[model samples]
Target chain A: MPSLKDVKTKIGGVKKTSQITKAMNMVAAAKLRGAQSKMEAFRPYAEQFHAAMASLSAGTGGARFPLMEVREVKKVELVVVTSDRGLCGSFNANILKVANRAVAELEAAGKKVSLVCVGKKARNFFRKSGKMRKDYIDIMGTFQMFNARAIAQDAAANFLSGEADEVRLIYGRFHSVALQRPEQTTILPIKPIEGEAGGAAAPASQAVYIYEPSQEEIMEVLLPMFLNVMVYHSMLEVSASEHAARMTAMDNATRACKDIINNLTLIYNKTRQAGITSELMDIVGGAEALKG
Target chain B: MAALIQLEIVTPKGAVLSEQVEMVTAPGYAGVFGVLANHAPLLSTIKIGNLVYKKDGRDDIVMVSGGFCEVSNNKVTFLVESAERGSDIDVDRALRAKERAEKRLAEAMAQKEKIDRVRAEAALQRALARLKAAGKM
Candidate 1:
């Protein structure tokens, strides 16, 4: 049996640990709010970009844009986005798992797969593999649109230069605070927005548009902008999802720590009571012997 | 006929403005143009300059960097890299930016650096647009 002093020391250690976890839980909650607001703020920009692209592409009348050309798939670049820091309970691991699975699947199909890791966790995970085309490290905490623009530009360059025939992005999609799932999307070879023809059937959509400079010039700018929007959207999603995952994980840790502290406290109280009872029994026995 | 059009100025950060306005005059790549209610469908790339819209006969100026504007269905949407209202422009910040860009340009000219010269020129243009929008230029 452990001594009462030892039990007390253990209880103190557990209490300190619980306090740290509780503090971490609160920090995560606050950070989650900021990240979620950032995600909400980006939606308007993305929506406006899409609406502009839809109308522009509808007027193009099947002009062959270089970014839209689909070529034979010889090489694939997987852009995996994850959190820069860990302790978020399987958030990074799930993304890496999905990414690895994609790489394996692509390799099995007789295509070369290269990685474009977007966070430190992904960089470290794929560091030893030697298949990295590029690894962007330590940008999650303060990522901006320029960061996404840079990544998209690199991916576009690779595709245009024939280094990679295709590019795909994998990120954790935030559905709610309690749910996030890994999602993959193809960002390259910019597909013509589906339902373009159907939209023209509407009466209001049939109006002729006066294009400035020219349609082709606007399209030339629009396609690249579309790619940038795709990358930026994914980055925003990953940022929000990371925070939610961390909040939930920290909350669970705090609760578990509380339960541990409760159990330890119960044991400490019992041990102290037992010591008091034994001392009382010894005093009573000594008094009875004196009376005899 | 409706006398007002919906004007929305959106950046990657968020929508800066979304309200009904009497008219909008933007700095288009082709040239500066105005849009009223029921204007024809149009799409144009914009430059770094001041944008003005009249609401209740009050002209509200906004500064926008290079982006595009789409006019459709009585709506004018500007998707720019960044934007700021005339009232939101911090004169001190704009002044500092102008000074920094000027210094960079001077240094680039002395060293004959083409890339630095180009970036500095763009920065100078943005700062000038901000000042011009605030009517301090």
Candidate 2:
């Protein structure tokens, strides 16, 4: 039987842990709100930009730009984005898993693969992978559009310089608090986003558009801007997903702690009752012996 | 009364404004252009400058950084990197940014630094736009 003192100490430790988890949960919740709002606000801009790109590409009718040029896939660069801190249950792990799967698939196809890790977690995870082209650390907390621009520029440079034939960005996409999944998109050699309705309907709508300073010139600037926007958008999604994952993980931990404390308390009470019952039995026997 | 066209200015940060206006004037890549209600559909790249719209027979300005403007279906939508309403701009801060950018540009010129010069020029443009939007320039 465990002693009361040991039970008491165990309960105290679990309680402290629960307290910490609760605090973390609250902090994550607060941060999630800010990140979520930022993501939501950016959605309109991204959507409009996409619509514009779709129409422009449709109207231009095969206008060739360097960024939109599809090249042979001899070598691939993966920009894996993950959170800097760990403790969010499986958030970073899931992203790394997807990225690793991608790398494996690429390598299996006789293509060379390189990595550009965007956060501390990815950097640490892929530091010894020998395929690391570059790693950006300690930038997730207060990352801005400029950070994304820098990363995009690096990827573009590598692609243009023939160091890599293709560049892909992999990050967690935040759908909701309960749903964050790893997703990958090609950032270099920009693919014009077709309208969701269908490709057939896109061209008809493009006919009425008038371009300013010619479609070719507009595309020269738009494609690079598109690349930058994609990186920034993905970064925003990852930020929101990180907070949501942490919040959910901490909440689960707190609930589990409560269950543990309850179980420990039940055991403790049973032990105490057993000790009292044995003492009563001993007293009764002593009285009986004295009377006899 | 002039026909009112829907005008919306959006940035990566958020949607700054959506209102019915009599006319919209934006700084296009080629030059400044104006659109009224029922204007033909057009897409154009815009530069860092003031975007003025007339609402209630009064002029309201928005400081827009580089992005795109689309006019369609009697609506004008601006997708800018950053935007500030004329009323929302802090003139003093804009002035400070202008001075800082000017100093950096001068230093870069003296040192013959290409990269810093470009960045300083961009910053200077943004500050000037803000100041212009606020009618301080």
Candidate 3:
């Protein structure tokens, strides 16, 4: 049988664990708010960028930009974004699994697969897996747009130089504090959207635009800008999702710790009561024997 | 027709300016140009310079780096690489940036390397824009 002191020590240890987990949960919650706001603020920029592109392409006589060229899939580059640290439950694991599956699927189709890992977790995994083109680690300690721009520039350079014919991004999309879903989006070789009318000279909006320099010049600048917007949005989403995942994971740990402490406290109290009762019974038996 | 147009200057960080303005004059790559309400639907790439806007008979200055601007339906949106308000800019920081860019340019010229000229020129423009906006130049 365990002694009363042993039960007491176990309860103390469990209580300490509860405190630590509770602190971690609070910290994660604070970080989540900042990340979520950053993600929210980026939506307007992305939407505006898309709207601009839509009207620009329509107004530009629908000339095919170089980034929008569709070519046979010879080589593909997968830009995988994962968390730098691990305490966030299955956040990193889930994203890494999906990325690996994508790579495998692409390879099976006879297309060469290369990775541009944006986080430490992804870098480590791809380093072991084989054929990692670039690993961007420890750059996202704080979310910055220039970081996104740098990555987008590399991806665009690869596509333009024919080093990689196709480019895709994989990251976790934040839905709410309780839910985050891993998502994949193709960014290279821009997909042509259906103009308002079916290949008509003028779109339905029919908004005749007067180009300052020329229509072609605007598209040339906007295409790469659009790519940068996409990458920045993805980075913000992943950052928010990581914080949310960490918050949920820490919350669960805190609850589990509380339950453990409760159980340990019950055992400790019962053990102490039993010890007290045994001492009283021994004293009573001795007094009764002396009276006899 | 609205006398004023909604001008929103947006950067990667967030929206720097979103207000109804009487007019907006930005530094276009072709040259400096002004936009008013009911302007034609147009798109132009802007260079690093001061973007001036008028509101309530008062003028506001914003510094924007290279980006694009879209005008449609009485609204002008500036999708810039970076932007800062004249009131928010630190003059000393802009001066320091100017010095750093000039030094980099001189070094590149000395080494016979054309690689950093483009970047150095851009940096110089950005610093000058900030200085001009802050009224330090």
Candidate 4:
């Protein structure tokens, strides 16, 4: 059994650790608030872009753009976005798990798969497994639209040059502070919804738009922009989710540390009381023996 | 009497301005273009420069980077890469940025790097736009 002094020292160390975790939790909470606001600020732009695309696709004949071309799925490139840093609970692991599942499914179907990891964590995770073809790091914390544009351009160039058969983006979608779900979305070869092509009759009335440039020209410009914006938005979501997850994890760790400290304090008190009682009993017995 | 036009200026960050205005003058790709109420439907790429909007007999200036402008149905929308209101722009910072871009441009030319030169030129334009909007140029 450990001595009381050792237990007391351990309790002190645990108390210090709990203090540190509590500080970290507060910092994470502050950062999470900032990230969440940023994510919210980006939502309007994404929604507007999507609405514009939906309206445009509804107005024009479907599959008129090269990007809308559905090709055979022989090779798939997955762009997995995760945080560069860790300590954010399972934020990175969940994304990797989803990507692994995707890889397995693709491989089973005799399709080759390549990875375009966007963060250090994802890059490092897949690098050891020799699964990543290319990786970008150190951009998640300070993400910018230019970064997204460059990445989207590279992916588009690869797809256009027939280097990859298809492109899909996998990332964690932030639903709330308590919930984030892994999502996989197709990035290339825009798919039109059903009953909307060739002026097909649908439940809702389709509005006609006067395309300034040809539909093909608009698509040529808009498709890449759409992809970049979508990717940027996803990055923002992941950032917010990471902060949220970190805040929650740190809070839980801090609480656990506190509980441990409390238990240790109780044990230390009991042991100290037992030692004092035993010393008193020895003194009384010595006095009684003297009297005898 | 001129009709009221709904003008919205949006950046990647968020919507900067959305209000009814009397007129708007924006720096177009070709040149500076002014739009009033009942203007024809037009779509054009915008260059890095000042955007002046007249609302309620007051003129509000905003510095904008390259993006696009769409005018349709008497509503004008400027989707800019980045924008800052005239009141928000810092004149000293703009001057410093301008000087930095100029120095970078010279260095790029000396090094014979076309990409660096292009980026420096863009930075210079953006800085100049901010200064002009702030009435420092």
TM-score of chain B of each: 0.95, 0.96, 0.96, 0.96
lDDT of 2 at A190: 83
Q: Which lDDT tens digits does candidate 3 get at residues A45-135?
A: 7877776677677666558788988898899999999888888989989999899899889999999998999999999888977789898
Interface RMSD of 3: 1.3
Model 3 misplaced regions, further than 4 Å: A194-207, A288-292, B111-115
DockQ by candidate, in order: 0.75, 0.79, 0.70, 0.34
* Poorest 10 consecutive residues by lDDT, candidate 1 chain A: A194-203
Q: Write the per-residue lDDT of candidate 1 for residues A1-292, one digit (tens) a residue.
A: 5687887888788778878877877887888888888878888888878867776776776698878879999999999999998988888999999999999999999999999999999999999999998989877777577788789888998999999988999999999989999999998888877444568563266467788979889988778878888888888888888888888888888788778878878888898889899999999999999999
**lDDT tens per residue, model 4, A23-90:** 88788788878887777777776766665566556556645666666789898999999998888888
Where model 1 places Cα greater than 4 Å from the true spot, the runs are A196-204, A280-292, B102-121
lDDT of 3 by residue, B21-88 (tens): 99999999799999999898877899999999999988889999988898888999999988999999
Local lDDT at A255 for model 1: 85
Which pairs, if any, clash in model 3? none
On a 0 to 100 scale, what is the lDDT of residue B34 in model 4?
89
lDDT of 2 at A91: 94
Expressed as tens digits, the lDDT of each residue in A48-161 for candidate 2 is 899888878777766788787788899999999999898899999999999999999999999999999999999999999999989987777674777888898888888888
lDDT of 3 at A80: 95
Spell out the clash pairs found in candidate 1: none
Q: How many angstroms is the interface RMSD of candidate 1?
A: 0.9
Task: Report clash pairs, candidate 4.
Answer: none
lDDT ranking, best first: 2, 1, 3, 4
